[model samples]
Target chain A: MAASVRTIAVIGFDALQLYSITELIRRENDYVILDTLDEQCDIDSIDAFIITPSEFVSRFDLFLTKRTKTLILADKVSSVGMDMSVSVVAINSRLSEIEEAISVLLNSAECGAISNSELSARERDVLKEIASGKIIKEVADTLNISVNTVLTHRKNISAKLGIRSVSGLSVYALMNGIIK
Target chain B: MTLFNINSKLCDIIFYDSSVISVINRFGINLGVGDYTVAEICRSHNLDENFLIVIINTFLNEKYFPERLLKTYSITKIVNYLEKTNSYYEQFQLPNIERHFNLLIMKSNADDGNLHLLKRFFDEMKNELLFRINFDRQEWFPQLLQLGNTTLDEDIELDNIPESAHPIEDKLNDLKSFFIIHLKGKYDVNLCQAVVSSIIALEKDLKQNNRIRERILLPFERALTE
Candidate 1:
């Protein structure tokens, strides 16, 4: 049997904001766009409800959980309900981070895994070097920073992502298109 | 009586306007003259305007004729003067020397279009050698040998044409080697035939290279065969 065409509805008032997100996640094979504000426009057939954090929190619900995965394109965690829904977190208007967030949301939906968060630039630099199998000292010398500084970034990366090992960092990087 | 007669004749010749007198003393016929106009002078001189112009054009190129004076002289008069002065003679340099050879190459008689650039190459190489070899006569052979090293020197910062491999002494050897190596470098041909063909081609190519070689690639056949 032929597969169904996956449809996605982008929800945003700002054209620029929508442009940024669409530009990032525009390459996905199984997606189409629908209106973001059309709430009752058949949530049953939709695979994911991607909501802006501001929009999602305003319509926050407890029982309105788990028809499809819910993702919030948010800068900070604002609302909490008892039921589990994924949050695609980005940081202070970082464009690259926002792109990573959309890609992570799409991947998580495919694998039925947890949502991923944005990486800081230093964390990304350290992860890239670490992924290349360079030792901490070598990465430090190349980056022109102290080894302790690299260690600090690694720790921050681990704490932020809940991944402890460098191998885990490599796996995360590969999965999310972080390092080549 | 004879001494007194000689002095009297000399004074008469010097003092009076003998423009009317048809008097000849020695080797040549002297045309007794009267100044009227240039047209009259030319007519009395039996000169053609057009023919005299060509003669002036040709003789004006003689090194001895001051250019300003040549332009001022009626072409016919200049031609007349030039003929009398035997100004068309060529000064020959040493026959076997390179400069003399270059002069021969430059002259119209030696140019066969095919041999023109070989002539130019000889001239350029001679000039370069003269300028480069600057010391007294003793330094001649050594300086010639020194300039023969055409390899790029560290002192030269710009891109330079690779030096001709054939130094004066080893030109024949270098030509032979060039023939051997490049004869069939591009196409398949027997060594002897290819050598002959490539040398002919390379000679032509080197000539055209100065004018338009940068803009267009000349065909191997034209350089070689014709």
Candidate 2:
């Protein structure tokens, strides 16, 4: 199957830098340069953002709220005083470096988006009950929830953890101290 | 999406995608392919040229699934190819990944707790993979071989067998993402890259093999059983 094209929004670069980065990005058919990010821009559609450190800092709350993959284009990594989690690439990085950063950023963003979503309190309780070797009915009884609610929680847990198997979920729970 | 044809030169095809060398190896073809076309190689190996081309094309392009062409080949041949693929994974790919993973962990800082998690995940993935290999070897392939012989084994429960490769595929992808995105601390970049690359290679191979199993093998089995 053809890979789904990833939309990238370039923000806060000079015309020359923008042209260079756009050209670099255009080299890969898998990536399309979306329109520049503005107040009216639909941030939800963007898969990633390439922005200057200043630009990222200026709209830090927006980016953080969106939790979109953002790459900071700076002269040096240490110059950016943002969270260490945010990826910083040198402004003069090679095309390969830029591509690698975007690829890794997008990949991690996908898994992070699911994993970073903390399980709801009720989901955790259901998880704890289920991970302790309780069946769905038993889990529902123990948690004082309906069987359908327990099933919903199980589905959400699997979706969040990217683990479909009960044994895998049990292992994850044990590893994370959710269960003894 | 140019499909490799019977006239496609082996050397040229290798130059196009070096990964096809492994695919060719499964067909019992080796290096020193020197100037020979696909037909010539097939003739020398006593292999069906169409079968060879279809397999290569399937590997080369994910979208190229010639179901009719695949059915033209004998089921036994397909089973043999799949058996070789399982052996390749067990004997080469799994061990290869483990070696690189070990080196990566060794080169990494001792206090990096995430590496331990990664190792645990790898072990789990490895066990799952071996279980699949064994299942195919002991059950699936044998059952396929017994096709059209007496009544089908009622206990085989072919319909109930889940998509066995999918979880392994997901875990491999997760492993790659973890290595690239989540892994931190000082470690040998080269070793880490090696581990990631090996994982990617195995993932690609598994995907291609899955295409064969899903699109070709399963359909053929269903048609015959029905």
Candidate 3:
């Protein structure tokens, strides 16, 4: 199954480099690239920022870029320097490394939404309880369902989502807002 | 250290430090399981003895975290433990502080305006601290536990979680200067120190939580990825 489209903005990458990153993301069809961080672009709505060293002037710029999902390109030592806030990558050239970096960042970004079209209400409850760290018996007790019924719901949820492990379900639950 | 021989009661962990009752509560080990040895009670509850020991140690001594010892525990367990610690503040400690703080305000024998300001600022700071904690409980901790679990087991990798915001630390420092130091110059040195200690203790608890996350849990998670 495809992930929900991630909206990304590229800043300070030269035209050729910008084309490469956006092309890579769009080829996957999992990301929608905006031309620039413009007035139409809600600062909060922008999912990730891939900014190059030449463009990286201040923390203020990235602070304005987005909150959580930022990838800074560093050649030697960028203006952001050793600041532990935003991720600073050493490679400025390789598109594959760039793609891998972007994927890792996006995956870890805490931004991205999951659609809830397929999940039933019961499945949603089970997901939330499991994700919030409740064990199966505890979840059964809380929901006032039979333990076997809770197990059945969990199995159905895993089958529908193709995510079997409790940890995987937990990630799905969090990403999909099945749990707070 | 509280010893637990076969004849010893299971409740000594709580008896040693009443706060520890909250920690064990996260493991669903209810109080008053009489005279069961530590090993016996752990077996009865099906709680891993080593895991329980590490949790108790982490709660008692913030600096004593052994990341490898903590590896057996799951993300859910750690999150629950941290959440319980967070709750201890607003549920028990913060209310106790507020009660005495009200008494201090009522018994103010001085004509100073800063005392009144201190009362108001203290209330706001407590609210802000609580609000930040609630925000973490709802948003940050869920994502964090997922991140820890993901990076630990799968090929997926996540960066270190950004440190949480503690705006109240600055507020508490301001209180120290405006109210506590001022009180020392005025009449009640003991009262000033007592309230200051409360603020310091709360700050310490929050900081220790941050340390446990950063030091023990994150390292353990990273090691799993490795």
List each candidate's DockQ score: 0.00, 0.07, 0.01
Model 3 lDDT per residue over A56-97, tens place: 565456554345456677675334324323566555444654
**Number of backbone collisions per candidate, in order?**
4, 0, 0
Off by over 4 Å in 2: A1-180, B148-165, B222-226
Q: State the RMSD for candidate 3.
A: 20.7
Candidate 3: stretches off by over 4 Å: A1-180, B1-37, B40-48, B145-182, B185-197, B216-226
CA lDDT for candidate 2: 0.75
lDDT of 2 by residue, B65-141 (tens): 77666666677888889999999889988999999889888888858466777778889989999998999999988
Best by lDDT: 2
Q: Which run of 10 residues does model 2 chain B get worst, by summed lDDT?
A: B148-157
> Each model's C-alpha lDDT?
0.42, 0.75, 0.63
The runs of at least 3 residues in candidate 1 whose Cα sits more than 4 Å from the true structure, single-residue gaps closed, are A1-3, A37-40, A62-64, A75-84, A113-180, B1-226
- Candidate 2 or 1, higher DockQ: 2
Return whichever of 2 and 3 wins on lDDT.
Answer: 2
Report the TM-score of the second chain of model 3 against its true counterpart.
Answer: 0.66
Top DockQ: which candidate number? 2
Could you tell me which residue pairs clash in candidate 2? none
